[model samples]
Target: MDFRFSPSDDAFRRDARAWLDAHPPAEATPRQWERTLGADGWIGLGWGRTPYGNRTATLTQQVVWAEEYARTPHTPPRLGHIGENLLAPTLLAHGTAAQKDQFLPPIARGEAIWCQGYSEPGAGSDLAAIRTTATRTTATRTTATRTPSARTTSPRTPATYRVTGQKIWTSHAHEADWCFVLARTEAGSHRHHGLSLLLVPMDQPDGSVEVRPIRQLTGTSEFNEVFFDGARAHPDHVVGGEGNGWRVAMDLLAAERGVSTLAQQIGFGEELERVLEEARDTADPLLRDRLVRQWAELRTMRWNALRTLGGGPDPAAPSVAKLLWGGWHQRLGELAMAVRGVAATAGPYDWTESEPYELDAAQRLFLFSRADTIYGGSDEIQRTIIAERVLGLPREARGQ
Candidate 1:
């Protein structure tokens, strides 16, 4: 495949860079960022057929936008755009006309936020074993949010099911307006059957939902534990039909492997650059070789990602990408500490003071990346997927 961008793409990139430089909302808070991006029509540029996104934008154009956007000095945070990037695409593919009309505009306008409710203490990547349930119940008057960004219309229908369960490691659950939840709709069902993807309201007026942020090693809480105690999902909110949820959820994961990845590489490049700058003053010869190797590996990972972008769901592709980046990031974290030498171990506060144990960026990166291999999917799980699916090896027996 040809590796260079075309002349037209170059021109488009220039235009994008100029506009971003002039407008300069990169430092805006998440809410402000969404409003600014939405007002400027930059929120969902390339998604096809939706009034919210510009379908005329080609794949190359999308990549160009992603690259430029990621490189800006202070690009706007994504805010609650799970509605735009992850959930919207899935909904565009499988949602009903009412669902699309109800959900898409608010997301396009950048007025709402969204979160995923997939992981639990019992199920993460092995999601078919999920025990969260949305049982059918009588039509009850319940407060409901249609999308993370918009309020539902006056009551025209009744609630269909009541959700009762717990979800752990839920990113931004505290701030999301809605959560796309995967739950077992049929009782006593096991593994990949009788599940439904329900659009649930995070801010139910009846106090049926609770969200508590999980503090990480970095001393920040971007993730949360969410509890749904008899929270109701309105009948129209059932996405992709009642029993086909596992398929819909899988489709969403496949969407996780797309052009957005190229943008992620840009951020990874920045982190590596910081590490290189710190390593510059180091007299140690060993750190130099590790830095050089990391640069080479990052370039290769970029190429691999480009080669596989837009390919069909190959089953092993997601696993391979996760393994590559997760391990690389964890290594990068280790290298950051090495560059700091002995100073890396010290925190910012005195033990006797009211507060203690603060970290700078490098320390935080080192601490957070420790879980890079664990979250999303573990290395062991990825290897299993590669062995069983990619290589056509015999499946491993349970309880081994």
Candidate 2:
């Protein structure tokens, strides 16, 4: 497959680069920056012309924009990416027309931020094991017994879901205006059955929803633990229908590893460049060889990602991509520490002081990348998927 960008794609790249250059991240706060991008129609480039007011771009053009954005220096990490990249694509694929109409506009406008509510304390990579529950309910109640005196009734109201459960490692949950929760909607359901992907409002007036940040090795708290106590979602907000959330969640995971991977590769390239600079004077031949290998493998990962573009949903594609990037990133992190040697062990603060301290760039990279193979579906789970689903291997035994 040809990976080269066309002349028109080059033109699109120039336009995107020009816009990013003119609007440096220092000029605006992250939220304001998001709004600015949305107003200019830069948020949902991959989605075609819809009433959502998103700028329509071809697949190659989307790649161009992503690469350009990542290549730009000092661009703040996007505050709207969960909405734009993950949820938006999922909605386009499986959401009802009403869902698209209601959700896409705010995402395109960058007015609403979103976080995912997929992981649980016991069900991180094994999403089918999630125990969160969203029970269907109505404002009124009705009960009847054989005895005439036992009959009771009340006025009916629109049905809603009373969500109750906890979600762990919820990225950006504290800042998100909304969350798409994967919860079992049917009573006594197990594994993948009877699940529903719920579009939930985060700002519950009754204090039914809570977010607590989990401090990380990098001294950052982007990952969070979220508790839901009778939080509500409209019955209409159940995406991909009430009992088909497993499929919808799988589709969203596919989107997670799609075009977004290319942009991610660009960021990896920047990190590799930093590592390369740090290793320039290294005397160990083995270390130098490993550095060269990292550069080559990253290039290969990019080409592989480009090759899979526009290929209709192949179950193996996402698993393969995840395996490649996850391990590569973790290795890069390790290499970064190796290059820094003993200096990597210490932070730039007085250890005896009681105040909090920060990890330097290399330390942060090493510590955070340790989770690369764990989060977003662990390496073991990815390989199992390939074996059972793609390679037609016998299923692994599971405990009841």
Candidate 3:
């Protein structure tokens, strides 16, 4: 990969830089930034003119935009990052034209927030074990708190699948407008064979969907538990066809690790740089070595991530990236806290066990990064992927 910007791309970069200078993202609210970005056609750079202000942009432009945007301060928190990063790409590659037309524009405009409905109490690391069911039926009801009654036909209403299951550690579920859910659509079907990926509306009139915020150690509620009780998805909403959700889910995961990760790695680079700047005056030899080692590891991760991009997607690439960054971030968090000495362990006197804990930057990093290894995919799961897919190892037996 050349990694050089074309002259036209440079001009584009200049324009973007000038816009950022004028906007100074920190001063505006997230929604306000979204409107400005969407109006200017910067939100979905590679996707084109429908959402953002541009038409059929090149991949180079996307890269340039990501690079420049990260360089600028007050870049609005990625408000609809899930929709733009994972879902849009998946829809482009596998969704029907109608699905694309319906979903993509909203994502581009930061209007549609999305959540993933994959992990369940029984199926966190082993996603193939998800027990959520979507039974086709004519009857519509909310609340799947009980086992769905067997199909009884009614001629009056259009048929829809009743989604009944629970998804835990669902990021942004509480605020999402929609969710892409993987459920068993085939009765008595097992493992990867009987699955379907359903795009479900979170704001159903039946009140079948429930989102409860999961308080984190950081005292934030970004993660949630989502319950689906007789929530409905039109049969037409299945992506990549019904009974092929396993494949669709895998493709979405691959998309999860695509070029967008370049921007993430860049963000990681900034975090690592901050660590270096903060610890510069400290003379502790052990701390100094850890910082240098972290820098080297970050460089290696950046290289690996970049290489995967040029070579195209692999089943294990995202796992490798996740494993790399997840562990790296956790360790960096520890180092950050270590540098803060005793203050890392202390909080404000008023902040007791009953009150919501307030955290400083280093304290927050140390606490929150603990989940880095567990949330995306556990470190064990990523290793299993690398062992089986990349190395051609025999598959591990899943207990029946």
Maximum-lDDT candidate: 2
Every model's Cα RMSD, please?
6.3, 3.9, 6.0
Instruction: Compose the digit string of candidate 2's lDDT tens values, residues 161-193.
Output: 999999999987998999999999999998989
Between candidates 2 and 3, the one scoring higher on lDDT is 2
Residue pairs that clash (backbone atoms under 3 angstroms), model 3: 41-52, 41-53, 49-54, 144-229
Candidate 2 stretches with Cα past 4 Å from truth are 141-157, 310-312
Query: Over the stretch 211-267, how does candidate 3's per-residue lDDT look in tens digits?
Result: 999888888887899999999999788999999999989888877766676777677
Q: What is the C-alpha local distance difference test score of candidate 2?
A: 0.91
Worst window of 10 by summed lDDT in candidate 3: 138-147
The C-alpha lDDT values of all candidates are 0.84, 0.91, 0.82
Rank by TM-score (best first): 2, 1, 3
How many clashes (backbone N, Cα, C below 3 Å) per candidate? Answer: 1, 0, 4
- For candidate 2, what is the TM-score? 0.94
Looking at model 2, report the run of 10 residues with the lowest lDDT sum. Answer: 141-150
